[model samples]
Target: MKKKLLALLLLFFIGNFLAPPVGHADQWGVITIPPGKPIKIGMGTMLTGDYASMGIDIKHGAEMAIEKKGKILGHRVILQAEDDGCAGPPSVAIAEKMCNDPLVVGLIGYMCSGGSKPASDIHNKYKVVMISASSTALELTARGIPIFFRTCWNDKIQARRAAAFALSRKWTKVVVLHDKSDYGQSLAEDFAENIRQKGGKILAMEGLTRGDKDFTPVLTKIKPLRPQLIYFGGMAAEGVLVARQMKRVGLRKTHFMSDDGCYTEKDFIQAGGKATNGCYVTYAKEPDPEWVKEFESKYGPRQTFSPQAYDAATILMMAVERVAKKQADGTLIIGKKALRDAIADTKYNGITGEIAFDPYGDRSGSVVVVYKVVEEEGKRFFKQMAF
Candidate 1:
């Protein structure tokens, strides 16, 4: 009888241990695995085609962080990078593939704001956490998606800075030029509104297509306004062309200003050459000496959003590790919902600075840095200013 009672007790203990507690194990058993492989996060950005420089830098930054942290966020991490061609359908396709991939619980990239916005919608639909290293459209954050976030400041802050910079200089008459793309138009409208609110008058507003070469018509109309300043909201290609054309037409008195596109890339200098002098613009952030040292070791002397990109990947991975730690047997289970929750709650220091996303997936207290041009020996170098 004693031996039988002992055997029954052992059977009861084994049954209790094997049977998982109620709803969690049964409901989630199908999707669950025994902490299979390392957590995999998909990164989507423009690794090719135009604007590939920014994309390359973004990838380098993230890759550097992953290399330092090791794959396994305490377990292992896997990063799959996809190039979206920085356009419409290609970007959508990339996002769709990442969303469907079981291993890719989170995503980081699609630097273009237009691409980020559309891709983010798909990410949210599939409950995949996604973050941007460069997209700064205010509307991207205005909608309040729980899983969407950005490492850079939004267009609103940039527009406000531009308005304040122009207004403070007593430049009452201003001309606005944009590329007619979403980024350009959005920032132009915001800058216009802020300038008006701050008592600066907009003398004229014009736009050009992305690849349009001839700006004679737009410049001719804008010149008549005799504006003190010209705010061009477009990429470097058009911006440089506009500056050179304006110089040709003797609109030298009007100082030019642009947003991130002009500052972040080297195109404005390369395109306009000597003509890019005296132009002012805004940059995302200044590089830290220590971080630059590290970046130089990995990537050469190319300036890009390496720090922010690194942070975005690191934050997502950290969250995945957190989820893995809380598993039943310390198994690393990197599912979509778990990864999303981990990314959503990240509060850590990034390569640029402290990173803590607001409810709308926007970083709080992120300021836009303004820059001025100083040309030497036919080369352009931007001077950072605190405004």
Candidate 2:
């Protein structure tokens, strides 16, 4: 009887030793970082192709934030960046790969809306958190993906603001154009709806391919309409081409307006030269001047979405710090659900503005600003106009 009792006791000790500790694996699972190991944050953006500069700017902004906060709970923070190609397929691949890695606690981007829309599903399935810096498609938040959030203003708000600005200027007869990408097409549709509802007339609504350089044909077809304004819903690559070709096709007097996509100096204003002057574009309001100066000093001239990216990264790190618990043996334990809840509850005062998230993971109280490209002292730059 004593031998049998001893055998039973030995089996109990071995089973308990092999089993996972009670708190280590929670309902949503937990991330365990052994001593001296780095905590990873994943970044997905278009590091190549036409929009490479924009993505590079976002990456730099996130890097700046990570560098500013040297470590989190005594563990070094490392950013693992992947190029999403600004398209659906590559973004899906990136999402799958990054979320599969247990070390990655959060994500910072999928710069374009087209990429973000599809990649969001993969992130949601894994319950990993992702915050985009520039993906502004309305449907992104509408789908109720709990893991996805954005620092940029939604296209619905931007479209309404753009339409209101145009109507206020009495440019009622307008032509709307889009690149047919997810971001451009949806924004163009919303703007058109707002214009019609506000008693404006749409002279023509057209779709253009993104990479095609020549827009003279489309401009020539619409020349006879003599619309007061042409609103192009696309990025800088196509935006610059359209602006330049509009002049060539004798639409010189027609006003040109666009969304945040073309709001860049190098790709739009400088590339379009005199054609871009006097044109209008809508983007988020200017960030704090001191913050801008510091960012420019560290990363050259700032691009369109760097400030938003900085805010996103900062907010993510803050949430990570909040939920991370240090173990007795120096191993860090982070509950995935706890981190998500903390992020959704974030109310941060960032360089951009007061940052907060709604239940849908959308940033609340975002402001959109209208800017005009003006020539001053023989150089071109964006001048903020009173909306």
Candidate 3:
């Protein structure tokens, strides 16, 4: 009996030694590799409603970046996304959720300026760093949110550029139409201010809301003013919609001008089949060669915000990689604060332009392009205007 008991004890000890500690096998994977936790980045954008097209473009770009970097980076990358709806309340709520999630170390966007600025406050409080791809409200940079950064230039720069481009072309009498949101109102205000400063006059100004299907009311109000050009500072969808409405109202003489929000190919075609002819908008045009080819091959001649959003995601990834510490198993772990500094210090060439940030987390040396929509082969093609 003593020998049998000794044998049982030996077997039990061997079993314990061979098996993983209780609950550890479940916590860790079967591979027994040291846990180099993957970086988690969150994204907030208007992935639905009227702005769905833009949101999809941004998402596609971001996803492509992750796919391209997944293998090369050693550690896996994960994305968590929520819809901000391009509004204030939803944006704040989404940002709050992302910042509160401990696993989420960084954020990519709230596509519109209205959404991004408010969310920046939430990110600041939580110490979560965020980078915006499309948000361009000047107030976003002015607030001095330390962790807030943007891949795209602000409305002030684009507005000033548009004004100069227009005046250079001698479109002195400019009318302005803006969406009621902060982005539209502020950009149009800046554009108008610049126009006045440059010895031009804003003959008329009009406003519209997010869901307004009929722009006839505003168009009629501005039609009689007869300005040399109409600058619409808002989204591409709204730009196209309003352009079509302007054509419908027999108000086609004035040249249509817009900000970066109106640069995409889809918006021009969606507004009306052929109404986009002669419309101009500011864009960041030098195509991202690395992504453009893959995107073109995947999307088949479709153009979208994939390049910009990809850059935003890539910047975040670079930041994380810079700060991550290798664990025993050769896995990496990065803290949020380190990630922010890495982002600020970044100087890599990105899909957009050089990925460098100014003091206020805005890109440096970024310039806007003015594109004129012209019909060719029964389709609208954006040609870079000389001005």
Q: What C-alpha lDDT, on a 0 to 100 scale, does residue 130 get in candidate 2?
A: 97
* Alpha carbon lDDT of each predicted model: 0.77, 0.91, 0.80
Candidate 3: C-alpha lDDT = 0.80
Task: Compose the digit string of candidate 3's lDDT tens values, residues 143-172.
Answer: 989889988888888999999999998999
TM-score of each: 0.87, 0.94, 0.87
Clashes of 2: 0
Give the range of the ten consecutive residues with the poorest summed lDDT in model 3. Answer: 24-33
- Residue-by-residue lDDT tens digits, candidate 1, 1-387: 999999999999999889766443321221232465565668888787656777888888888877778756345666788987666677688889988876675788877877887888888787777888888778989887777888888899999998898888888799999988777889998999999998889988887888778997788777878999999887777887888888887788988899887775466666577788788888767766788888877787555577778888888767766664336664544455655655667778766787887778888889788888787675568888656
Please report the candidate that would top lDDT against the real structure. Answer: 2
Name the regions of candidate 2 deviating beyond 4 angstroms.
1-18
Residue 26 error for model 2, in Å? Answer: 4.0
> How far is 165's C-alpha from truth in model 2 (Å)?
0.3
Off by over 4 Å in 3: 1-37, 71-74, 300-303, 329-332
Candidate achieving higher TM-score, 1 or 2: 2
